[model samples]
Target: MKTLLGSQDNWDVVENGHEEPVTTEGYTNAQLNALKVVRAKDKATLYLLYRAVDKSGFEKIANAKSSKEAWDILEKAKNGDERVKQVRLQTLRGEL
Candidate 1:
């Protein structure tokens, strides 16, 4: 996903922080563009995640404000897979 977004020039919205300063009155044009980019990217990510989620996870994350939040919630709701951990450990030990 990171590579896909980077190729499309939208990776910053998903993976990098927006560093543009905000004012009390409003945002500059560039800042506004950044905001729009982040919002659109977040919504796209959320939609993609939704399609791949189970009913229970969907219900739990339906109201998430952003894709990152939804992903964190979904992760927290899932059980830890010991088999996956063991595989990772085995791979690491092989590298030793």
Candidate 2:
């Protein structure tokens, strides 16, 4: 599993597991890379991943795609949607 730095709240597991005492540092590069890859393929996942990485990742993802698509992905992901998240995870794992 990958570990991210700069905020644990940006993780789906952390959110779902209701983990307490979120941290803002100490993430592995592999985890950060996975988060970036996930965000690139799905905006919703990107939003969640944002909580772990720097804001620059968000800007990059947003700039890489259309505003409409980015917003749509963020909205859907924020609403607890999982389809896109699953797809993003699969892509990150290179199982797609």
Candidate 3:
């Protein structure tokens, strides 16, 4: 997934997340176009992510604001959170 996104120059959007340009004060055409590009890439990434996961997994990232946020949520769900990892490691050490 990372490789795929990277090949299309979208990994940055999914890794760092794109900031939506503020529109309250109005913007130039260039700014709007730039935002459109970023938004398109982000939506594409999101579509890929949605297709990659199952129902339960989908639920986890359903409310994610961005690809990066969804990626993070999925990663933690699959790998477990830091505390969970620590506990698992402790159990392994005890078994040895």
The candidate that wins on TM-score is 3
Model 1, 1-96: lDDT tens digits are 556656666555545433333552577789678677777777777777677677977898899877777766766666455667888999999999
Give candidate 2 regions above 4 Å deviation: 1-24, 44-96
C-alpha RMSD (angstroms) for model 2: 16.2
Residue-wise C-alpha lDDT for candidate 3, range 16-65, written one tens digit per residue: 88777556258788977888888999988988899888999999999987
Please provide, for model 2 over 1-96, each residue's C-alpha lDDT reduced to its tens digit, 9 standing for 90 to 100.
134412432344323322122552676889667656544444443454455445654654455343234444455555664777887888999964
Q: Please give each candidate's TM-score.
A: 0.59, 0.22, 0.77
Q: Considering only N, C-alpha and C atoms within 3 Å, which residue pairs clash in candidate 2?
A: 4-27, 5-27, 6-24
At residue 4, candidate 3 shows an lDDT of: 84
Candidate 3, residue 33: Cα displacement in angstroms equals 0.3
For candidate 2, what is the lDDT?
A: 0.47
Ranking by lDDT: 3, 1, 2
How many clashes (backbone atoms < 3 Å, residues ≥3 apart in a chain or on different chains) does model 2 have?
3
Candidate with maximal lDDT: 3
Per-residue error for 26 in candidate 2, Å, reads: 1.2
Candidate 1 ranges beyond 4 A from true positions? 1-24, 80-96
